[model samples]
Target: MLKLFSLSSSLSILFLASAHAESQVQLSHVPSQSQVEDFNEPRGASKGVEARPILVIASELIKYFEGWYPSAYDDPAAYCTIGYGHLIALQACASIDLGEFARPLSKGAGAALLEKDTRTARIAVQRYVKVDLSDEQFSALASFTFNVGKEKFADSTLLELVNDGDFDAAANQFGRWIKAKGKVLPGLKDRRACEAALFRGNLQSGKNSTFDRSDCAGLGVASGAGPVIDIFVGE
Candidate 1:
């Protein structure tokens, strides 16, 4: 069940500074069927690498894998995350001031945050990727960059091979990122595999049967203070 907490009056002082900076989208209703249909339609890749955006299906993939907490929760890496895995701070949710945050957020509000986060991921891919890509390939890389963080993605052998236009080798690099909090998490392995498959145009899942793995089941642990994800690493 979705957990909710009433905002205590004492938190007003804490809320003053951040309330203006946080997501203000109050979703009162779900997207219409037509809206979903439009989003699902292929936005098509740009001729240049700098302008490409992930397809709608790619964003949905990120959303499905990320934790759905209308109320903030401590993520594996110890970040205070809320609304489809959007990380904020390490502080308790109550101590963080989110203006108008009514505790449990609606699915629509959560999705809005996801959409916003994906844009940053998309920009990272566009900025570093030099080769032209199919919609699926760009989407796959965008998802990878989103989870792994832009700094790591930028320095990754995966990015090196991708910019070199050696896609097959790049596809294998996803498996290398299967550890989090300095331990191997089983969940990260499958996530990497699916992402690899998606880059190879063979991705399929229960939440989605669409166009994708590097199954890193036997991968060794890597050291990290954060989640298997590195989004906060260089930020």
Candidate 2:
């Protein structure tokens, strides 16, 4: 493992070298926390059919919030995590041996693993969502699933509202997940707000995108689109 002292200096060089490491180009898959400006979507009601999922701007959003961690560490849930919030092991830190991650994880590997981890969310959104969604909306949901576990999302009222074709109510549910382990986290709050904005078809860019909100109210009054972030597969 690279020493912590040299990590920052060595990181960029390492990433440049490892840029060639990810040969098999791939793209891919959360929960929680909330911001963004509200906007009105031009589309009407959602079509009651499954659509293959694709991502737009979710990766950059995720990376911006999740930051980068090139080493294994325990998350708030005690899971052995690595890369960009990838759960290498779901068990508690004391229960699992992290000897395998003794070496410093590379940014390239982390990016690949991020794509790999996001696959689960993409599959979940594809399988469970019963309504047709725009790319921005789907990306928002995908981002949500990536943060929260699949089971939680599957059983969530948000999913229920989406299936019921109640988008406004569904949008409101994004704020319900801002708490981690019962405490309201600022990071989570900002993420949900941004996601809600995207879900409402408002693509927010630059420094002013994040807002400190707790719910999805008033997110239905605006217009715009977001940028594409990563490789995604859809039908």
Candidate 3:
């Protein structure tokens, strides 16, 4: 009886060891560390692309559209804005303790605010876009979302078309959002045209690439104005 019990115990131990070996083999086939990192990144963050170039293009586009506001001032729609279109009252900037709403921001403060806003915008772009995009596409969308708020972008036909793989239609949708307070702002028109061109791959990189405002010349004004909010303002 003792011998028989020992044999049964040895068989059970062997079976457990075999199961452990099989699990290790299965785990070996699991996602790699890089894959896991890519999977875990927040929405709007790019994977398998160099982030610096995308960031540079996005920053340049945002700078061009938003301009630099070193001090908090009332935007056209009357929101307290600072830096590169960052609203002073945004929840994201709540902890930063920006003094008075009308106070002038230092260059360092402005740059820091712009960086944080850009990060937020980029994350929004990544989160809302359900399709795989090239770096340029992602950057252009990020720039667009930075100009238009995330809520608007999320509800926009542009995002719907892009997710549906209708690139052409999505590219054309940028022109439709040019109105601000029932007026077609020339700045927004030009910005949207540039963004559309970027989305279509018409604008190349390097020294030769230029954002031509002429493309928006004939596009008629849109009467339905969007909410009068500056970039990076939280809901």
CA RMSD of all predictions:
12.9, 15.0, 23.0
lDDT of 1 by residue, 1-235 (tens): 1232334544665686456433221111111111122234455322233435676656666666675678876554345667777665544555777655547888898888777656656777888899898887899888887776666778777888899998987777777776554444455666666677778876544334432223322333323312333323322
List pairs with backbone clashes in candidate 3.
43-127, 44-126, 44-127
Per-structure clash totals for the candidates = 8, 24, 3
| Per-prediction TM-score | 0.65, 0.61, 0.59
lDDT of 2 by residue, 151-173 (tens): 56787777888889988777767
Whole-model lDDT, candidate 1? 0.61
How far residue 136's Cα lies from its native spot in candidate 3, in Å, is: 0.9
Worst lDDT run of 10 residues, candidate 1, spans 25-34
**Model 2 misplaced regions, further than 4 Å:** 1-53, 91-100, 205-235
Higher TM-score: candidate 1 or 3?
Answer: 1
RMSD of 1: 12.9
lDDT (CA) per prediction: 0.61, 0.59, 0.60
- The C-alpha stretches of model 3 lying farther than 4 A from their native spots are 1-53, 90-109, 204-235
Tens digits of per-residue lDDT for model 3, 1-235: 9999999999999999999886544322211112222234585454453322354544566665666767665444344567666665423333456676447778667767666655555776777788998877887787777666666778787898899998877877777766554445566667777787777776554444433445433453233423333222312
Candidate 1 TM-score over all chains jointly: 0.65
